[model samples]
Target chain A: MDMLEQYLPFFTKLTPQQQAVLSQNTTRHTAKKGEIVHNGSLDCIGILILVRGQFRVFTLSEEGREITLYRLWERDICLLSASCMLNSIQFDVSVEAKKETEYWKIPASVYRKVMQQAAPMANYTGELLAARFSDVMWLMDQILYKRMDSRLAAFLLEESQLEGGRELKMTHEAIARHLGSAREVVTRMLKYFQSEGLVALSRGSVTISDETGLRKLAEESLR
Target chain B: MDMLEQYLPFFTKLTPQQQAVLSQNTTRHTAKKGEIVHNGSLDCIGILILVRGQFRVFTLSEEGREITLYRLWERDICLLSASCMLNSIQFDVSVEAKKETEYWKIPASVYRKVMQQAAPMANYTGELLAARFSDVMWLMDQILYKRMDSRLAAFLLEESQLEGGRELKMTHEAIARHLGSAREVVTRMLKYFQSEGLVALSRGSVTISDETGLRKLAEESLR
Candidate 1:
């Protein structure tokens, strides 16, 4: 019960009997960094509530390109991975442990039963799904409207914000994978940023030298 | 009550009293083609259940480019437009009448109250939301991975199937808007398709001459 409360603050909204059922059915597990939590079409992955560390949800293209849809961090729910609970929502998307992560996994049956019986839980799930859809729409807008340089700059700024620092210790290949661009494209953009003194890039890291310049570059429509 | 049943078969799952409440509260309306059903930030648009004709849900870019996310027909619900029901799911996406459309609109408060009281209704809504998210992911995949010509061919084929015909009487500007490409880019591609004997294009229309050839062209990675 305490473990359930740790990941799900809404646990208190359920009746006492519902809380008992959920606590008894949920399993806590850990995954190592880069570990594939669920591959495409693994229908029993369940509703995962991340307790610590990061998880990435992404899809791979036929040409082996990777594009991240979104990330799950502490206290976030992995609803998309719980495909068994969702009717007629079949797609090829994967979830992986971005860092060594610990989470609580509610079995698909348990989650669905709880959701059916609990209005609060269903409303919360709906809200989460809506928020995720909004994120995907925003990403689509960026890809459709923004130029590569502006997108790269924006990505860097967002990554820096996520990491809570100006220095990002990520490879160009990693950045490209996140942005759905080629490594060469990301490297070229970083080089351009360096030339303009907006950022300093080394072999596997980028540091924002002029944060204001980078922000302005990100906001500007290069085309 | 029969009107409610026409738009939503899930109406049967509710109690008779609940059904009566829903029937009394729901508003039935029709819109002409190109009419905006709900604009951005109109948080009270409610749950729209399409009864006839087509509805398009899309997001517009700052540069005035339009990209379609999905279309709704008979029995489909416009859950995103019910922004007040979905906590923190605000965005700039708009829904429009693609053809002369008839729909049932349930006020947001009434819909939320019914959903909270009815498990089946809540589950149905979740399934609908999941399906929409799946669609957005598929679109993101097309944009991130596929080339323009290939995507255009696939879109035309899909459109032909949707309309149950080989001829699409849509202008290049309309096609470009759907594909999130420039009108010039769509014109150039259509001309190429013509030269390759895949399609015949006239003002405001495109006729698929050799669908197999177009499919092959679409599958080819002509980088």
Candidate 2:
């Protein structure tokens, strides 16, 4: 399938000429599960418009601890990868494929040219940038104000919605990385949740049994 | 001075007609020390270009804890205040005057129109948005990976840089709010710093006696 054809719905406001320039210059790339796609590169920067699979946009500490800034799903657009567009951007975020993923990569120069000529595209880019800022702020708030149990509960709730069911099929290690926590901490919290009868743990998955209890615990910090 | 006349250097990219519209519509506002200037207003959103004094951009929790996201000094441009320009921005940040401040208030509608008409202005806005993202991400990284002592040390170092002195005049309570910590915790850390001869504590002030030691302590977590 043509890359532009797949993302035409996303770029609905683009003129035909602008779309042609982007479609011709935007390249498609694929990554296997657990592959690091973009690192701290100075020259190679552009917008990543996800067409399929998932991405973990995260930061890795010098000590090697991982904390996910956020995740990107189908149709989500990322701008941190295009940090070179702004010399003032000192963000050091990495994008990793959580699973087999494919996306269109629009080079920064091409996007810049198109954006200069297209008001809709520029506005859309601005809005995307704004949304990402909101997501980062929300994450910071949760980490600062919310307790570990509250954060874990909220993450589980978010995962349940994404998975479309009660059971979450992820390891404690993966969950720890997502929450910027230790695996032992996550396991201990899971045990506490089980004791409270909020969730039931299986070999690799945890099922929510008392969602109301979990919800309250998740929002306990706010109150 | 006219608001536009004062900020003309910042908006050098604007066309003369665009300048006329923004200059005519932009208003100047004043805030006393410790006054709330912008709350959660959706309608009154716009760019805040500080001409003098300081602004603390931060978030407040229901429990009344305050954690500063960043600060705006003389000549700094803030886009989060103009968040209404992008409907996707869900950042709920408030601005407070750290000191008597005078700034230009470019309303969202006027700023949006000017941005759409001027490519340079649009690009500059994008870069500012990107820089803010970097600031937020850096704060999150510190909170997640760095220990309380390291974070406190780093905060003091930053304050020193901002104040251009080894002695800081901030109270422990004010310092705690900035670091998202408790006043008791900040006091305890100060005592430790004093005991180690790294700093000298007097009534309502902490003076750094050993800058190298403090710098090392500030960066200990990253190493």
- In the range A73-182, model 2's lDDT, one tens digit per residue, is 89888777877766777867788898899988989888878887666666667777788788777667756764677889999999999999999999999999998877
Write out the backbone clash pairs for model 1: none
Each candidate's number of clashing pairs is: 0, 0
Residue B117 displacement (Å), model 2: 4.1
Q: Distance (Å) between predicted and true CA of B9, model 1?
A: 3.8
TM-score of chain B of 2: 0.87
Predicted candidate 1 versus true structure: per-residue lDDT over B1-223, tens digit per residue: 5677766756898999889888888888999999999886754688898889999998876667778989998888898788778775757678999889999899988998888887778777888888988998888878767888889998999999998999999999999999977888899999999998999998889999999988886777434
Best by DockQ: 2
Q: Whose TM-score is greatest here? A: 1
DockQ of each: 0.58, 0.60
Candidate 1 at residue B68, lDDT?
Answer: 91
Residue-level lDDT for B212 in candidate 2: 89
B105 in model 2: Cα distance from truth in Å? 1.2
Error of 2 at B143 (Å): 1.3
